[model samples]
Target: MSRLLDMKEFGEAAPFLRKSDLEILAAQTVAFDDKPTKNIVGAWILITDPLCAGKKRAWIPDEKDAYIEVEIREIDGDKVIVETKDGKTYSGLFCVTVNPYKWLPVYTAPVVAAYKGKRRSEAPPHIYSIADNAYNDMLRNRENQSMLITGESGAGKTVNTKRVIQYFAIVAALGEASSKKGGPATKTGGTLEDQIIEANPAMEAFGNAKTLRNDNSSRFPLKQNQSERRRGKRLLPSRQCHSYTREALMIIQWNIRAFNTVKNWPWMKLFFKIKPLLRSAATEKELAALKEEFLKLKEALEKSEAKRKELEEKQVSLIQEKNDLSLQLQAAATEKTCRLYEDQMNESKAKVEELQRQLSDTNTQRARAQAESAELGRKLEERESLVSQLQRTKNSLSQNIEELKKQLDEETKAAMMAEELKKEQDTSAHLERMKKNMEQTIKDLQMRLDEAEQIALKGGKKQIQKLESRVRDLENELESEQKKSNEFQKGVRKYERRIKELTYQTEEDRKNMARLQELIDKLQAKVKTYKRQAEEAEEQANTNLTKYKKIQHELDDAEERADIAESQVNKLRTRTRDPGSKASPKACS
Candidate 1:
């Protein structure tokens, strides 16, 4: 309660809370205290009641007098559920409730803390978990990351912002300590974590102002700029501490201008006085560090200058030694050495003349060899042509053999078909004879029936009955013969089908034979042309072979002359090398 009052007072001095608003709040508190006594209501009753708990209720607004229904669906460790009259719903670990007496803001701080550093899906929905996720992302990526916290006035942006900054400071300090691992501790006089934590109070004091909606609303916005170095992974604030003072100055200037319209603000005067001291201190520290670096560079420069002088002396000695050696070489050059060189030159000229003669003979040999190779190449081409022609002949012969085999197969197939036709014709002839014999038997029975009828008229009724019985017997025999005749007809149809199939097969065979005959004729023509080409190629090969042999002989003779010239050149070289030898140039000649 005391902390709350202090915050209220601070808001007033910081010009964030208006005097009229404070007065109105005070009057409302007093009126509430003086009102008639009513039964004390516990929040637990609303949570546990069957009708109200986990159910929606409509209530009239104090300011607008309009009724709105709000439902409280659930309350769990992870989240609370609330729904409005329009079917809109919200779920989170924190919730705000309005009562007849006051507005209550409920927080599930412990539940949110339990899920810190967990993924958004793993953790329950909460703002703290979002901050934790952003921090983890920054650590994992080693790159710039930003989180934007935006809301209307009085939405607790400032409070959440402070919490996030505090979290980073604590985490960074702990991480730095763990990384040291018993190494020497780093000085943290003005580390980024310390500066950020220190800047929070100053930022609120100058930038916050009063609004109708929020008592302590930020008039000037806060921006978090995150960046990373191109060559290193250091965060922006770590390398940009100098820029913080400039931002602070701007905030101070803004506060001064805002309060200038009003009179007598002691905090504003205090801020004006401290701004210069902060800037000067930062400037002095930077100057001192620069001076120390400048002195170190100067000492390094002097050391390099001395080393350069020592190297210059060594270079002078090397130049002088080179000059002395040149003079010694000049003194060693004498008349005898000159005369010896002249003699060597004359000997080299003689050797060169002998080498030229040898080269001329080698050229002649090379020309003959080339001519011989050309003649051999021509013979090879002729031989290849003959070989190709023979290969064509072999292919033609193979084709002819294939055609002959096909013809033989066709002949064999035709002979088999002819034997089958002869058997079928014999069966057909026997069937025709049986048919004629049946017809003749039928005619004889008809004649015998006519005679029986005449006899019946001459003799008694007994004879007529006997004659009718015989006629019935004869009719049965005729039916049996007709059945046999039908069977023969079916056999004749089967034979006719077989003959039709054989005729179609014979036609196909004839076409195949015709095609084979044409192929055989074409192959025979090719064979004849190939034989002619082979004979011509063989004759050309023989002619080229004789010419090659003649060129080979000439090449061998020219090579022998080249070898003789080479031996003479070798003797001249040995004489020049041995100065003590009795052999002189004139003597060799």
Candidate 2:
């Protein structure tokens, strides 16, 4: 049996171990009955041999090593010979072996295959293979498995446990994916594989620590329970399962010193008694969230307070402006300047009205003068026509006078010839009388023609002189009326300009009044808002005061309760010390 064990180890390490090294190992005696000799010899040959060491594989001493040496000298089934570097020979189960990195892969490969699908018996004997096979059997039987991994502080227990969990998670996830035709499905909206993998890191963060033998060593024991639930035909992990591993470890640590003294205490009763206190204490996460919320509320309150202060400042400025405007209004009402402007406006209006009346009068006068001038013009035209007619009559009279004078001269000649002829013929008395009558009539007509000429010339000259005087008088009157009309137009323009100035000034005053009224209304509205804000601030302050008082009251009540509990604990200790208290307990019951 010892030879077969040696051969098996040799066969397993043959790929990396040299033939000379195997011959040296096989030449040694194999001990199977002595468990310590068998294990030590096997560990030394497989792990500490220099021929089996690769570039990354070397021997590491145990923590208790006092010196380095090739201690193995001989081997046998019943006894083994070992020699230290100082030539000290010893044979016993008390032996130290070095850990070799080269053996880990050789050990893990078969376990990995066993996890895949290979039979556990076909794999080499290893703790990992055994655990893997057991986990597989449990999964096949649809049963639960509980694994408790414990060792000395630095035995790599935590690391081995993490490896086991990783193997199980990977193999199980693959199996689940293969069972479903589609693929691995995370119906819970989270990757189940990742969550299972992450549990190691989360647990290590709180539970693992560094030690001399191991960097990541679990300081406390862990109890992991994995179970499958049968719902009709489907076998799945139980969703309601919970692990209080960390809490249990914490409780153990808390009562570690007093565990022996209070070993018989009723833990269930004590836990119930302190459950309310545990609930009252704020958790780290809850306290952190509350601190963050408090800070945010404080910042918001500060901003609101700052806004209120700004509004108050604005209200003060508005009040000052309103007061100033009121003072100005009062001063304006009392001062003489407004009355003076009004008087000036009234005077300008009166002047404009008077100028209008004057302008109207000038218009009427101008119209009358225009009418008189037209009448005079008509009379002048009539006088001119009369003068022309008199001139024409005078011209015709002159022509008639000339023709009559010629005829008279011819008649006088004829009369002289007739008188001579009558002397010759001894003229009759009736002829002499007719000649004398004709000469007298002719002399009377000539005198009447000369008087008519003098009368016509004198009358025409007097009419022309009267018409010339009337035309000059009318022209002077027209000139004076036009001057008055021009002066009235100038006055009307001056009054219109003054009126426009007054209207503009009144319009400006009206706009100013409207603006002031609007400003006052806005100030009043701001004052109301400020007042409302102040009231709200006061109410909030009062509410905070009430809350502070309530918290203070609760704090006092909690302190009183703590004092009472401490006194009762002291009294109980005293009663426990006194044996007479036992009888009192029986009497009370």
Candidate 3:
């Protein structure tokens, strides 16, 4: 009774709540973080044992069945990556699906039916699961529920939405509702369900084509639907209002109390007591008493009218005060909005300027890197072409040396046989020494060629110097062999011409080998220098690419901030109306 009276005494006023008295502090909430007031609208609630935080990535501990259990964990994002690799598209409340781009058995009738009564937690994460939860919540709370299906273009938002709609169609169906409403004589001449289902294809083809920038977007019907159903839904709110029901109820209660008090009056009791005695004696005293009562009732009625008029006037005064307060509130709200938008716009402008400066610096650096890379690239290509030509020349020199060496062996063998026929032992000994020196020089030349092919600059240079000294010794030996041959010219006369020709050919081959060795050393050195330049160029290019990407990202963020500022400006413009321009409400007759 005391609580009732307290409530009645405090009637018709909005309730008051302080921040400290708000119900935001639950057992799970450890503390409120109000330090970050600039970005978010409200303070953040700090909680303990968060499922995922403070980690780059982690795989779920349960490796065997990550798909079966999508609950968020202490691990950050590794489990999500692993799940994607294993074809698990959903993680907790988020349905991160890929476009299968084809029909699947997952959304069949049986599957839709399976999710009808099950709670979201009872099933694996899916679009149907979300829809089922929404439906269940709407039924349980007697309120509407909305699910936003939003993503970038080609993200299957439409496909997922269709699945949700199909799920609802199956789950919220009244048994044979179509047949009961649109029987055989209906316009479609089919079950009401069929006509309803047919309307959806037309709607999906055009109405739900994302014509509106809002949730559950639909196109306005013009040459479309042309149905009474659409017209009936165009009702607007009524402008008429009535007297406060609370005040009316209070007036009724007062009148009832007054009537009860009058019923218990002493005059009423005396009249009942004297009714039988005065029934036959019609007297002027009774008439005078009745007249006095009528006058008293008339005065009472006049008083009630005055009291009612006073209450109406009081109500009007309260309404006037309320209107003034509303106007003040609107002004304050408008000012706050303007201030907030101005701050945001200023911050956004500063950020954009900073980003532009950074981008200009990045462009300068990129231009320098590109210029250097282009110059280096041109030089490298030119050197590479020279290296290719040198390589081919070196190969031909090597082959020619091999053929000349074979000729030397044959000519030496023939000269030895001719000397043996004449019994020239001294010449034979000298010829054997020349053959040994020639073989040693040939081995050195082969080593140099091998080093050249490998582009070993230091090793090939050393080998080439050794070959030069060896070639000089071989030339002196060849001269001695020529003199020895002259000593045995008579005994070995038949092979003299062949020996001279072989000597001349050997010297020419020696000169060619020396030139090839020099070319190999220079090629090896150029290759080393070119390789270094190429590496530097590649590293610079990578650095430039990374810088460009970073600058682009910052530029994108700046653009988004600027867009937000502009949108806020637009919102303020829409809401900042002239309070005095509003007309007074029209009174009903």
Candidate 4:
């Protein structure tokens, strides 16, 4: 649970396990948790055994046959322990998947790491080696076992599968080397196996490629086996894997069998030479041996025109001989010189002439019959010759038609084969280009990831440095604030000292005000004494004024008259108001 929790915390790490980072541990060292008291982490087991199958190409290990299992255990607070079914345990940081059985080489990790250097071939051991070993065991013991492999499409399933099969074939073919002994086994040996191996490179170059799931997938079609009826008209059972081809030995065997059958047929046919026909069998001793056999056919044809001509000449000679005999008989009768003899000669001539007439008529009738027969024979022979010529012409035309059809068939087959080969080549080339492109893409992604990691490291360092600087500045500012707080305390002490001094000065000013008020009252009493003396002097002057009043009355009357006169004079000067300012100026002048 702790491992699972840790993985959950680090989520991205779980899903992006590269092939280079993943490792398959050995079966023996793996341990499983069996105690009920201990916590279970996970189960580990071996899922495949490449060496079990008789055919190396058959890569799937049979589950019912064999497997290795392991279980992981957690102990104490920080320790992880692995315990196996065999009662073995270990303490370490461990990685456990569902499968633990298959023992892959430890060098796989380093080899995978070298992919950046463009070297991928060395990572894991080829399955072919295991297959070869397994195949050897089977052959040595005369045993056979079926192999099965199951995996998702792109996980090197087909490639591993092919390697297993190839291993088995190579191992099984080893005995074929002995066939070089010039015995029957020599025909079955290395030459045949070498050809098969050669064919594989060509097929792989054509059929394998990069699909969405697999970097190198094969595109071969499933071969189907079919049963065909041959000319023997018998059921010949045979076995073929899909797309199987017949071996060269099988073809040679078929031809030999066909040759033997043709020699044992029903007819006894002859093939004598044509030159022996020209020589006469009677004169040539060697030819005489065949005389009786061929002479009868020659005689039948010889009795034709030549024999008829010879028979006509022989009939003429016989007629001329009979006339000569008749003339002699007539001369003998005349030599007798008697009258009866003369009468007999005359009778003989008449009989001869009558016989001649009958002979002539017979000859004419025979000639006419022969001419009719010859004409009929000629017509029959002409018809037969025409029929024979027509048959020969028909045979020649049929042979030419068959030959033309065969040539046309061959040309058509060649064209079709050429088209098929071109298509296969094009498909193979396209797949190769795709594989190259995919590999390039994978390399680019790896480089980008490395660049991102570098950028993140630099940013993290800068952030740490900034935080450190901020902390130092805050420390300095705190010291300055403490110093300002001490200065404020000193200023409060000075203000308290000044406040006490002002209180004393205020009390002294109140006392001085009371003294000034007393001085002002004494000055007011002195000024009242001087004012009483001046009142006495004013009483004496009032008596004098009463006596002087009588005299002043007379004088006042005189002064009144003087005042009136002055008033009159002033009126006379102001007598006329000027009508115009210019007239007033003339009067003043």
How does each model score on TM-score?
0.21, 0.21, 0.29, 0.18
Best by lDDT: 3
Q: Which candidate number has the best TM-score?
A: 3
Model 2: lowest-lDDT 10 consecutive positions? 232-241
> What are the runs in model 1 whose C-alpha is more than 4 Å off?
1-332, 409-419, 438-589
> Model 2 lDDT vs. the true structure?
0.51
Off by over 4 Å in 2: 1-456, 521-525, 552-589
Q: List the residue pairs that clash in candidate 1.
A: 16-209, 16-210
| Candidate 4 accuracy as lDDT | 0.43
* Residue 322 lDDT in candidate 1: 88
Candidate 4: misplaced stretches above 4 Å? Answer: 1-74, 78-124, 143-146, 174-589
> Candidate 4 lDDT, tens digit per residue, 427-533?
57546755664576467446544654676665766655655785687578568756855675575456445444544443443344344334333333333333333
What does the lDDT read for residue 367 in candidate 3?
85
Model 3: per-residue Cα lDDT over 476-527, one tens digit each? 8678767866776665564777788888888888897888889888887988
Best first by TM-score, ranked? 3, 1, 2, 4
Cα misplacement distance, residue 447 of candidate 3 (Å): 72
